[model samples]
Target: MYKLRELERIDLDRINKWRNDQNLIACLGAPYRYINEDVDHEWYEKYLHARNNSVRCAIVDDKQEEVVLGLISLLDINSINRSGVIHIMIGDNENRGKGIGTFAVNEMIKHAFYNLNLRRIELGVLENNLPAIRLYEKTGFVREGVKRESNYKNGKYVSMIIMAILREDYESMPSLRSENDE
Candidate 1:
């Protein structure tokens, strides 16, 4: 297991390192560049300003809450539309492939649907990120479409697949549904 805690100022340093990791940046579909402390601090400030429209959490170890595992978030919340975008990053290589991502993603999905009352949660993943794509599919997210060559990375354009899970989908997913919710 895993648990999610509020993203704190203290977590920024670890996040900054993860953001600047060359390998992670490629999967994130973001331009590769060095992110310094000042830049990350500024980003955190902006995140606070947009709190109403976002819920960013730090995925931590259940036994050792202080041990940061990664980050997961639901952003661009549209109250009227009842939808949001989900994003997750398992910071270090050693921490991945250990079911942590799945646990954190499921927890976030639960929060989105039951807590935030979001009707739909969506995310985009690099086409080459097979592990992540598989994880999302396993969690009941249906592939909507692919944005052909939508992202420029390493001097080339990469395609990203759009995936989403509707509230109805969650209701029918046995692994996600609990008896209490029924």
Candidate 2:
């Protein structure tokens, strides 16, 4: 139903627009970011092309116009540690809750563990984003801990919840471990 495609230059515009969406950015633990086309162009030139420590992909829905349903990526991939942090966003609220995020996440995690041979994958979630927290748990991520008063966004301080799924934990979950077999 969905596949991960390398993020090309064309995708920067779409991703930049997605980030500007209030709903999408509101739930992110990262500081609210605003970007214009020039910024995106610069980002593509510096980071996307560098390929130093990350892998980024856009989630494409086969049933649709092959539009990017969202993005799923592995950031800060440390070859020495064999670990990376998962970063994701289900582009639009309308495209969410339809199993799209879960599908993309499972595929990325499978690639991270089996293909990339990474040992650990982790993510941070804003405490108020209950839906995302629940989604992470359902996908096999265990609650690791929390960063108290991590950031002051908008008006108040919000805690960041840290969660992770070890290589062993992901392998044991039969459902999330075999996207390639499909």
Candidate 3:
């Protein structure tokens, strides 16, 4: 089984390694840049310090002796609107296709809507990432719109599709449950 927990300092190296992986760089459309130890330290500090608009967590596979399989976060939170953008990364390449991403995402959505009292949770995925797009759709996030030619990556410009799930929609979805009540 897998569980979502607060990201800790000890996981920095693993996180950075995953962040700098070429597959993640290409699949997630990350900027072509190296993520070193210093960068990871700074990012961790900011992630923990930022109070108004951020929350990050590590996805742990408990069955695997608590190994961190991935990470996810809700960033750029708008309290007034009760919304935030979701970001997730399945760092373990071997575990990528095993539905861990969906599980982590669902956990984040539960926390956002139930604990954070968010009204909407949204995310953007590259149009060509059919697997991720399908996962998001399966999780009840609708394709709200598309930003044509938004991302210039991998020798070309690609469209970015925005997906979102509202509080009501989440509540109505059978697979999701409020974190507080759970």
Candidate 4:
């Protein structure tokens, strides 16, 4: 089984390693710079203590010892309006290109709409990253528009595609429906 939980201090080292990984970070839009353990610790401190609008979680294999797979977050949440922006990073290379992201996203969407009572969950994907864009599309996110040349990476600019899934759309997803339903 897979689960999402609070990112703890013990996972800090591994998260730092992935943050410095050239190939993995490249796909996730991270800067091509290395940070030391001091920075990692400081970053974790901020994450642990930071403010009110988000739910930050680490994806883990619950069948085991909850070994962390990656990170996922709901940012810029507006409680009054029931909306949040989603962000996911599969920091583990061994866990990439599999259906793990889609699975985690499905579960996150359920939690957001059902548990949190959120009406809309949105995300932005780099237009050039086909694998990621496909994952989002398959997970019930509909492309809203493009933020033209919104980010600069490697040597040039890249556009981002805005995509989202509303509570209504979530209810109709295949993964959200099953014969087992009562």
Candidate 5:
């Protein structure tokens, strides 16, 4: 089982390391931008101070005693509109393809709807990223549209597909909610 918890200052080093991993970088369809110590420190400080965004939750393996397997966030928040962008990164290669990303994302969506009162949650994934797109679809997100040639990586351009799930859609999905909700 995995649980989402607030990201902390101590996790920066691990996060940065994962961000630079060759496989993960390629999966994201972006060239890795290495951050120096100073830049990483600055980034952490800014994230710590930000109010509108939430760099929430390192998905931890419970049996492993709080080992962070991945990171998830709700960004570009618009409180008045009750919406935000969902971002996720599964850092540990060993932990990938284990359904942890789906679990983490679903938890974040629940928090966004129930706690944050968010009406809509959205994300963008590279068109070629089938696993992520399938995960999002499984979690109630529907493909809204595509942005052509929006991402340039590995000497090629790829389309970015937009996916979104509304609160009403989530509320209607019986299997998605825990038994306590009804």
Candidate 6:
């Protein structure tokens, strides 16, 4: 089983490794860039200062070692508008394709809709990232629109598909467990 927890100091090395993985970076909408330890530290510091507008969590293996398998976040949170953008990555290759990402995404959705009282959660996925697109669709995120060639990666541009789920969609879907169960 997997669980979500606050990102801790010990997770930095692993996160940095994932950030530098070219194969993984290609799948992300962000541009590929080398991230050194110092840069990672600076990013963490910024994350700490941006707590009011973000909710980042480490996805952990709960039944065994409690090892961090990935990270999930809700960024650019607008309390007045009750909306935010969500992102998730299963950094550990060995832990991928084992339902960890699904668990983390669901948990984050619950946190946004139930805990934070947010009505809409959105994300943008690389047009060619089929696996991620499928996962988001499975989680009730509908394709809102496409940004043509919005991101430049690997010497070429790629489109990004915007997806989002509103509070009504979450309430109508069957859940593995109720929000209050968390």
Residue-wise C-alpha lDDT for candidate 1, range 1-182, written one tens digit per residue: 68999899999999999998998888886689899999999988999999999999999988988889999999999999999999999999999889988988888998999999999999999999999998999888999999999999988999999999998998898764675477
lDDT ranking from best candidate downward: 1, 6, 3, 5, 2, 4
Residue 136's lDDT in candidate 3 = 93
For all predicted structures, in order, the TM-scores are 0.95, 0.91, 0.92, 0.90, 0.92, 0.94
Off by more than 4 A, model 3: 63-66, 176-182
TM-score of model 3 (CA atoms): 0.92
lDDT of 6: 0.90
Candidate 6 stretches greater than 4 Å from native: 64-66, 176-182
Cα lDDT tens digits, model 3, 54-164, are 988889977663588898989999999999999888887798889899899888988998899999998999999998998899989999999998888878999999999
As a TM-score, model 5 comes out at: 0.92
For model 3, how many clashes? 0
Candidate lDDT scores, in order, read 0.91, 0.85, 0.87, 0.83, 0.85, 0.90
**Best-performing candidate as measured by lDDT:** 1
| Superposed Cα deviation of residue 147, candidate 6 (Å) | 0.2
Clashing residue pairs in candidate 5 (N, C-alpha, C atoms within 3 angstroms): none
Give the true-structure RMSD of model 4. Answer: 1.8
CA shift of 82, model 3, Å: 0.4
The clash count for each model shown is 0, 0, 0, 0, 0, 0
* TM-score: model 6 vs. ground truth: 0.94
Superposed on all Cα atoms, model 6 deviates from the true structure by an RMSD in Å of 2.2
Top TM-score prediction, candidate number: 1
Instruction: Sort every candidate by TM-score, greatest first.
Output: 1, 6, 5, 3, 2, 4
Give the C-alpha lDDT of model 2. Answer: 0.85
Displacement of residue 150 (Cα, Å) in model 2 is: 0.3
